[model samples]
Target: MSDFLIDEELLAAIDMGSNSFHLAIARLDHGEVKKVVSMSEKVQLAAGLDDNNNLTDVAQQRGLACLSRFVGRLSSVQANRLRIVATNALRQAKNGQDFIDKAAKILPKPIEIIAGREEARLIYLGVSHTMANGGRRLVIDIGGGSTEFIIGEQFEPIYTESLQMGCVAFTNKFFADGEINVKNFNKAVSAATKELLAIANVYKEEGWETVVGSSGTIKACRQIIINLGWSDEKQTITRTGVEKLKEKLLKYKHISELDFEGLKEDRRAVLPAGFAILYAIFNVMDIDRMMYSDGALREGVMYDLLGRFKHEDIRDRSVQALVGRYNIDIKQAERVVKTAQKLFDDVAESLKLTNEDSDLLRRAAYLHEIGLAISHGGYHRHGAYVLEHSDIPGFSQIDQNCLSHLVAHHRRKIKADLKNEVLKVGTPALVYLCLLLRLAVLLNHSRSDQMLPAIELTVLNEQQWCLTVSGDAKQWPLLVADLHDEQAQFKHWNIDLIIQSEKFID
Candidate 1:
């Protein structure tokens, strides 16, 4: 029923959620994301996690099969215009990379695993766009592997968290036998409440003016409650409605026995666990009522992609935030950023680099000194840790991981083992980017307004680079020595750095 040919200006996002895989291909109409075609399949990937936390082969097959189906739907979309993101299930899986590798074979783009807080941030992004300027709001999305809680104004999230509580996970944990009894139900509720303990006080203190729920679980609950006449149509999910739903759910002998008016067939099994988690949230957060939002993570990913196309990227904001929070030397950072940009521009076409790669180098330049906020010693390692662990709003886990490596090796003695790891991800020219940042940093070591000598960088091959130093060659002794010394470090990563200069080196 949907045609991409009708709309060339389209953005596509695939949400590889724990319980489902969703695809939304949308085009911008009047500055709003309008879905040309949206599809969701109940892959239930969380149910495939073994006791060892490895994604089982069957589960991977299920996910891959779903993606293969989605590939047909995505035929009209360019690979560059699409984003694929996996949430908590894959995040918790030991063999997540294994799954992603297989998925990479069929999907338009490689799947990106987002951190929990980043997940919360995107979920809030989607919800905020759909709301009608509704004051401060608390948005909750319960997936199969985790639950996201976000409190934000219209577009800015004040607090965000992805708690380890979800329908599929809880069903396996608390309702394994599928016994529809009050004891099992209460156990799930209590477990959810315990999970919320750390975040409850913060959400309450930061307090939202209204509460909104999103994703399949909440949508199913709202539908069942409103259809059953437990809650009026005006109140999709109220405390009273949830309590009544729980009472009715307990009346069933087993999960398969659930037969509510508006309950979908697929949601029947996970309903009890989802309801329990929602009930716990209601009790812990003291919520009297909640509204449902149609927007969610996939929608959020689409909007984020659209923003990047519009040059209103949130990752830029994140990098600026890091610079300010860590009190990075702004002038020094600017120098490195400018030099890095120039170097990247010089070697970009030769190395098949992209705008995304350029952006990565620029962001890493800005946050290179982020670790100085902690301590001057091994600040590079500190910055890497922060980038890897911190909730950078618009960055995927892979991007953070790449930036971490770039920052980690920017000024260090690139360890042999780490060098191998860096080389393993050579597609984005990460090693070359590291080398460029190092050169940029080295060239700006003086940290003064005095302009450094004009230098041009060119790639000789995958493993070789050439730097041509021009301008006043007399002021190049210390810089020449620094560049000479950095060459050995560059060689450590199996990259050859050839320096061309006149009358400066001994």
Candidate 2:
């Protein structure tokens, strides 16, 4: 038991939400997360959006300050054990990269701004973990700028949707003056219902056995319902409770004077608007009652990080799914992957590369010919375009760019313009990796199991690389021709590629 528990190490997650920032530290006990500590601050980063949809300077400063404090407490956690995620606020910000750069300087880990559907998937994971044994569960999370709806069985999400309606954003639009009335409340709820209408039909048809809510808004709403005596002691927010809360909230006519039994001071400003959104969701989606879940996106991030270490990486699954969807050639991909790995191992130490670099080489090799599915002519460009533009799950924009560069130049004539662009973003390491990938693809061009000669790669200096092939090189004339062609490409990048055979040795 002690040995098993030792493997279940401590994990931490930071959720930089639109409305708030949260940090959670947990320990895995019997496959369940036991919360050790947690912290949250009302950042309202989404509400700081300027007219151009960029995060305001004040908002960026506030976010950075909060992350600095969060980083202080995360001193014990390793970079790999900690996961940071940004939500709708960063997603909407045109200057998101600016803020990300500032935050990365202060935080212990890099932040991943997940896509909306991915957000829905993680929300369901968090909700499902906290819920009791049940059939299909419908999970809804109303954030400051977006709301996520998901239906899942056990731990796997089946349906996920994200709608652009939330507490803070709605408040700014409908109740920014702090005045709340029946007409304004109705307008807000109507707007929320309109957004839900897009997915309501599909979710209804799919159906669910239970409904669960997560995040600050839902937690606050549940408390209000229980304190107002509208629901039972079990803490479930019922439809009747939501309706009554709306009626009571409308009586105030202003957010400042709005006093509710369970409303916290921090929640007072967004309460009316959040309640309106919840009311619309319940009415539109026909939710009878929703049990609250303590687990949310941050918990899901930690769990996902754990999975990566345990070899259940979603990125691997996503890559396989892409291959299956594109109908890529499995045998050819395996051949390329094998050849790339073999070359990578030979020069990796001399190249000063990490395991991650090796992994990147393998993935690029596997998907190199994916563009051939589009067209045989200039498929490398097509593949690069797809990778750069496609919404590949589990891949960041930077990750996609790196993969795109590798695939785009794998077999092409490396032009002067392409060399400059590659040099701008990557170090010598990337250049070497790209060279290895190109050589591997060239070697496997025949795509047959004829087994070529054992090749050795040596880095002579920053400006040159050498490949020595030993075996019956004369038997494969095409292989020899490809190597000669690759030499021209090496010249374009200011590197020399030398192919040595027994003839050269003699």
- For residues 31-113, write the lDDT of model 1, one tens digit per residue: 78898898999999999999999989999999999999999998878887899999999999999989888887887677899
For 1-506, candidate 2 gives per-residue lDDT tens digits of 01223345788999988999999988878767777889999999988998899989999999999999888888766666777888888989999989988886897766778778877777777777777777988889999999999988998888888999989899889999999888888899899989999999999999998888899999998988898788866779999898888777777967889677767788889988888999999999998898888889888877776666666767777778878888889899989999999999988888798776887888888888889889999999999898877766566555667788999989878886777787654556777788899999999889898877788888898788899998776677888888998999988888899888775332
Candidate 2 C-alpha error for residue 189, in Å: 1.6
lDDT of each: 0.88, 0.84
lDDT of 1: 0.88
Which one is best on TM-score? Answer: 1
lDDT leader = 1
Candidate 1, residue 420: Cα displacement in angstroms equals 2.1
TM-score per candidate: 0.96, 0.92
